[model samples]
Target: MGIFDFLKTKKVNDETFNSSQFQNEILAFALWKFNETNDYYKVEKELWGIQDFDLSEKQIKIIIEKLKVFNEKKN
Candidate 1:
């Protein structure tokens, strides 16, 4: 491999980075909403509105699980 080959391979796609950042933003918003309302359904609904169905079921479930853990620790 050339000396610069590693540099090319190490570069991350902007789209992928933005997608992950967006997911983190969604998670942060969901957590904040849940903390404020203490209602999972409300937070889910808000996330749906913000994500506009972009997030998959698995992602949603993971967010819900995190929220549950956060709630437990909070109590």
Candidate 2:
């Protein structure tokens, strides 16, 4: 391996870290919205507006389902 290869690896790692961080931010916002409104459709629309990444329908449903379970346990 060359010395420059480490730079490429670091870039990939940074991108992965940023992506996960963004996901966490999205989930946090979604959870807060869900807790407040208990309306997944509104949360989905809000998330779609704020995100830079392409969030699929399945992913949105999964997040909403998880949030519902979480809210149920908290109550």
Q: What residue pairs are clashing in model 1?
A: none
Residues 2-75, candidate 1: write the lDDT tens digits.
88855542322346424867557767888899879989988877765653335545566767887787778978
- Candidate 2 residue pairs in backbone clash: none
- Per-residue C-alpha lDDT of model 2 across residues 1-75, encoded as one tens digit per residue: 987854442212335434767557757888988778778888888766653455656666666776777778978
Reference-based lDDT, each prediction: 0.68, 0.66
- Model 2 ranges off by over 4 Å: 1-24
Q: For all candidates, what are the clash counts? A: 0, 0
Q: Top lDDT: which candidate number? A: 1
lDDT of 1: 0.68
> What RMSD, rounded to one decimal, does every model reach?
10.2, 8.2
